[model samples]
Target: MIHRSISEYFSPYTLQKVEVDGKEGYVLIDREGYYKGPDEGIDIALKLLLAYGDAGIQKALDDENKSIHLENMGFDFQKTGRYVRHGKPVYKRGEFDLFKRVWSFHCGFCGKKVSIDVQPEYWYIVDQHGIRKSNTLSDRACSEICAKHIWDEYLELWLKNNRYSTELGK
Candidate 1:
């Protein structure tokens, strides 16, 4: 049998109301269980908290119900050549389109130009090979926020579809 700490077994991210100096704000507990400074700002922190909360709830439901496999509906990771100091290979979702021509797409969440080579906007990856794959959604976004929004929308749609299928016994 294996052993795991509560923090390790549970989520690595936590939101806490904290005070620094004379100001009060929220701080995030990072993966290492260390208090990350409040430099992430309140809005982003709240958004991250909501996203993580949704993820945790979904995880629990998935574990207990087992009717829906959300992991199989998520991203498809590919091994990259890069490795960390711990000898673990870095994984990425989509290969960079480095075929010489300029490829661009509008962000699925925010209407912004995303290109292979651009400032303030770059490539984002969506699961290309999955039941949740969408042609209407762009494969790229301008920022992490937009990317998360796109993913959330996709997941919502996928869950709805799956629920309908299971209910209808299809």
Candidate 2:
């Protein structure tokens, strides 16, 4: 069993064993505070540690255990899933670890996480409707959905700045 402790989880909130797709699977703590690394800090440091997979993760966990009296580190997790705060059933997916797990880009417009084999590309953008739309350029590949999402987000910013604000009356 994969055992990990997130500074974000309840002391009792632990990993549970469950079958997924007829294979050995773990119920990752989908709760918030699942990760307690530095906030708004360099993501590379944290992700680099996690990229180690089983052996690497174990070492980190071991290191954390060694520092019980000092700084707490990764976790004692025997499972293979990352921490998610609250574990709510928003059915929301998260950024997968490319170092450890292979992933397909989820279209920004479509919201479909494609398999790496399907496109052999990098990340993607999803759509509001959760379907495949476009993909990032091969050299700089991202999904069309993500592209659109970014576009929409940009447009919203543009509109916000360009559009007249009624609150200006106040």
Candidate 3:
């Protein structure tokens, strides 16, 4: 049921719900007008948008006189995760709005979209791979139970890695 337009990301490419082999899925069209299918198509579209936005940011950074388009303004690489704001001009203004629209979805653990209006008291950022230090987006849990599950799983793996490192005396 997840569907979105690609006009904000780039030209021609669109992400829409479609029947793939009689099952519900998403589709992504390329700039060359080629059709790609399945959920991965949507994922690819997101990555493409990030890359394009990064390029624009780099361009503006390289030249003081140059300015990035309003749509590409607040897309930053230094800040990552479910939602991050460094409070810069481009970000402080309204750049993260576009990202929010694209990332508007349900909790990764329970598949329930966290209602912004409800303001649930229990919520957690699920760093499954312990890669929060890296430039990768982590999942958000809507409830404390889901959050605990995510943390426990991550901790188990982290402990195993620690044990192995200690055994190797590294």
Candidate 2 to truth, TM: 0.22
Q: Report every candidate's CA lDDT.
A: 0.52, 0.39, 0.44
Residue-level error in angstroms, candidate 3, position 155: 0.8
RMSD values, in order shown: 20.3, 23.1, 20.5
Return model 3's CA RMSD, one decimal: 20.5
TM-score of each: 0.37, 0.22, 0.28
lDDT of 3 by residue, 8-87 (tens): 53455665678978999767777776787657666776876876667465554434322232113222333432222233
Report residue 42 deviation for candidate 3 (angstroms): 71
**Clash count of each predicted structure:** 0, 42, 0
TM-score of 1: 0.37
Candidate 3 — what's its lDDT?
A: 0.44
For TM-score, candidate 1 versus 2, the one ahead is: 1
lDDT for position 6 in model 1:
73
The deviation in Å at residue 72 for candidate 3 is 42
Over 1-170, each residue of candidate 1 has an lDDT whose tens digit, in order, gives 22347765676567777788979866678777787665655656687587567746666555535423532333222222111112331212343456667767777678877665665345354343454545554756677666655655654555476662322211
